[model samples]
Target chain A: MSNTLTPVLSGRADSPRLAWVLKRPELGVGGLAVVAMVVIGSINPAFWDAANLFSLLRANVITGILALGVMIVMLSGGIDVSFPAFAIAAMYLTIKGMIALGYDGVVLPFAVATMIGLLLGLINGLFVYGLRMIPLIVTLGTGTAVRGLLLGAVGSSQINIDRMPPALIGFGRLEFLRSVGGGNGLSTMVVLYAALAVMVHLMLRHTLIGRSIFALGGSEEAARRAGFNVRTTIFFIYGMAGALAGCTGLLHGSMIWVANPRDMVGIELDVIAAVVLGGTSIFGGRGSVMGTMLGVFTLVLLTNSLIIMHIDTTWQRIVTGSIVILAAAATSWRDRRIAA
Target chain B: MTATPARRMLALRPRRVDPALVQMAALAVVVFILMASLNPQRFLRPYVFDSITYMAPELGLLSIAMMLTMLSGGIDLSVIGLANLAGILAGLFFHATAGASGPDLRHAGAAVLCGGIGIAVTAGIVGGAINGLLITRARVTPILATIGSGQIFTGIALVLTGGPAIVGFPGAWSAIGNGRVLGVAAPLVIFIVIAGTIGGLLTRTPFGLSLKLIGTNTRAATFSGLRTGRTVLLSYILSGTLAATAGILLSARTNAAKSDYGISYLLQAVLIAVLGGTNPAGGRGSVWGVTLALFALMLLSSGLQLMRFSNFLVDFIWGAFLLLSIALNALRQRRR
Candidate 1:
């Protein structure tokens, strides 16, 4: 029996492919999210209502965008705790700068906001790569600094958009897909999120840089030995995260029509949780854009259901926290079981 | 010639003392300079001491709890949630037993002693056990597992109280939290004793050494026959207990227990642990370093408050300090 097991374990090609898919691991979380959505929708008719569905997707857009950036960082075997602060900072600065300069036109402000985001990302990248500092520490520091900058810039006042240039507000309200009944539709942001998700999926799965990311995450030393520039990979990953965060900031500004320094406070935890729940390993080296999308959806649905049920916001936080923990636990247990 | 060679060798050898202690010393010097420069006259006053003393108890206890888990190479993100829940539970128990009509001395005493200490400790241990079982046995990571448990516990607290605060505890309980005992607040006394006990245990006891071994090198520790799982589990239990104790103290001090009581302490506790030189990756740290770090943090916050900074500013400062300390520590390690 021992001899037979050894042969199978070391078998040349046939069995290894099966083992690879089993170990990819995120498939389980993705499956679970689908099951949860189906079960919940079956139980509550309102869950399937087109208006509610669109609204749910809309609510998750900001988190989804944030999670996309986080997924990139996580895949690079690093964590970024500063994305939320960066987002808030980007939003405040972009709004205030646009207002201060009287560039009320939509396109110019958008580009400037994105450029600010890219610069912020570049700073984070430099700190993590050039300085050889830990991502967690570097990002945490930047997160704080960014938040402080926002507070100092905006003071204590919330900057409201009174008559935003049609194009900017249009991004949030523009419907891309109208339902057959004509009572509900998908907004431009949701389409953007889906397209971005697809793009990230392709980048992670198909591109050479994407493979290098996986390699770096799997083992930095090995990746370096394989002729990959580990520092460059890390820098780009963090930059991608920052850029996505910037996009989310713009989305947030458009949706709320206000930029408050304190808005989306403590949202990093949610982003991390969503990424983890989506089946990305906290230690990195593994992730999936699709799984993360499902995770965002699951969380948004959970929060919406809680609201519909009239649960307090505090309890909702507790529940969301618990679900995140349980999801990570379940994934871990499954991984161990497969290993055995 | 032999003596001179030996002296050279001694001078070349690297220091083996705890980095955390050294960091704490550096932080203290920085604080001292700041205090002297900012407001020398008021800084030395008893009122400042009073403020520092008042802030120490719960935060100190929280830092110690965070230190234990971190030393074991794990994190307890749920400490804040547990503390909040425990505080709320203690408040509810105190109010129920003591009656809302007025301060019932006997009932209040029972609540503080039994309700606060007994129930809180038990709950904390159970919470820790749950986290341990999930992480060690079920293979869940520390952050996710504890976070999940934290959520459940917080939810339970909210459900128990219907999301409102539990207030109107007997004045005696508040007195115990607020009163001076031997020239220090009672919570401060408790904090000192607990810190001393924890410090002694980590340095002097076999269990402590086992924790260090596990934290430093899990595989090696396991190979050496240390019960790694059990040791990790015990650390979580200790963390949970301390968090719960902090919760009870907070409830006693405020004469109310709200769900938000411990929410703010999460970042602060982790910051104290890291700033005091506790490695985020785990293994090397000191109890004294954590205690001193707590004091430094408290002083910083108090000073910032006095300067009329917003809560957001204080939060940003804490986040910055945490990041800076860890990054500096990493740089130091790389040089070594």
Candidate 2:
């Protein structure tokens, strides 16, 4: 039974004094992450090497950013399988538009991309709020449509940015504490990931809108009865997700230095998986930003360690798929166990 | 409006004329007229119709498979994955036994056909069974379970085929893909027969009744003494098997099997099933509706191609149509 969604560590609170641990949703994931690092680090000290770790972080940070967005949507009881497509479209447009305008700057391209993403997310919000349609189907359709339209706009011809504004790539490349971890401390992308995580965490933990999101996810009818403006919250949540995705697309593109319209079409699954693996319930009402980050690291570490050992990336999907199943199974087991 | 005996009898008849079907049917007719007027030269040709007949069935089969799952109140996102995996297995079996350059190819042709089918069908049933067990025993929601299994199946397919499409089937393999039966494509014949059998199973069997009841309300069905778990299990397995049928036809038609073939169909098949009027919440659908929806979509798709619109535009239109239909349906339901 795949519904074993709540963290086993948190569930242990029923036995006593472990309630403190339950309050820290990210603890178990973080501990497991440390164990994973030590194991992988011992297996191959190269994994602890700065370059490999940085590369792993770089490989994961896209999903890391997107997972924060996914966590928001999931926490609100709606799903957006279309965010990758949405992000990809916004990224493609921004890159192409910037290249055409010969514009190159960190803020300008990112702002433009984020605004585009916001608009698209607003459309998703409108469908959920106005039409009263199922969020999953609505987003799936719109997401597909966006990708198709983007593909139509950009053919097989790959858009290369030879004159990429140094400021844009520099933002992604900027590293802090370069002397640490054998001269690989951290990149600006990691900084951005942390910044976003902190911002979202504060908003979720302290803000009224954040409380409403949790309430809405817990039960729409109950939220409505509690005087939460469910429609407005849904709009804001999906819109925020969209804007984040847009930023993700640009961040990913600039990091890679190419605007391949076809890439990341189905990458939302990875984002969703990472968030869920972090102990987020797929049916909503519970998840955390920090846990999601840990989840992202855990997945990336597994993948990076395997690739370090010369195992093919194809097996990564197998493990991820199995983890999703196991997580879901755990949730189901928990539900039944609690019921009993 | 006074009801006589005859009028009362008519009112009691099943299927009180659904407006959504009527609306869709009208849209189909209008689109046909528009296509004919814009591209009469190509649209009017028999060969154009032949191509539609050929291409529509594979997509149709996948849609119907989704429709079956939807009928039971769950969806099989893994259907396409299962279908492709089945095809890949059949392909691997054929490749191993009667490859083009094999010395025993002369005697192994029949083996290729038989073995190809035997392996493919078994793969479908097994995949479907796994889906069933995951949903019923594992207690995973259908979407998450299928998504996970879909990934696994796709990974296995990729690992087995090593990314490249496996080709080089026996010469007779062409008959199922390219050969004509009477006036229809062999693929069409296969599609129709399978659709009809599945349709009959859904309509004529007690299993169908139980599934519908289960979908409408699982607790109610259980209280009323139906094996809800078994019903869920059977429906998913059938959906998987149907996906396999599509996979086999795909291999036969393309003369190849790859991990990613018809990957796009995952979205489109869902589109078709929903467009065919299967309730997303489950319990109410008809194969006839799916068949009709298949015609509408295929017509739109073929028309767009006939006009030389890029394939991406076709994708756009399908997505737009799905959104529009759902919106309209919601509005209509609210009005009622």
**Top model number, lDDT:** 2
True contacts kept of each: 0.55, 0.63
lDDT of 1 at B142: 82
TM-score of structure candidate 1: 0.90
Looking at model 1, the pairs that clash are none
The C-alpha lDDT values of all candidates are 0.75, 0.80
lDDT of 2 at B45: 87
Over A1-340, each residue of candidate 1 has an lDDT whose tens digit, in order, gives 1211233345433366545654554555556556667877777767777778778888888899899989888888787878888887777787777667666666666666667777788788887777666576577667776787567546757876673444566666777568642666777788788898899899889998898888987888899999998877877788788888887887788877777767887677777778877778766677788878878777777767775665566577676777677667655654554456
| lDDT, candidate 2, B1-336, per-residue tens | 344434433343346766656766887788889899999998988887888777888889889988888877888989888888998998777667766445554345675688788888889889999989999998887878898888888889987877888876655665677788987799999888998998888878878777776777777667667898998899988888889988888887887888888877888888878877788777777787788788888888888998999888778887888888788878887898
Give the true-structure RMSD of model 2: 4.1
Q: Score the docking of each candidate (DockQ).
A: 0.47, 0.64
Q: For residues B78-181, what per-residue lDDT tens digits would candidate 1 score against the true structure?
A: 88778878777766666566665563743456435565567777888888888888889877878768767877787788888887888776666676678888
Per-prediction TM-score to the true structure, in the order listed: 0.90, 0.93
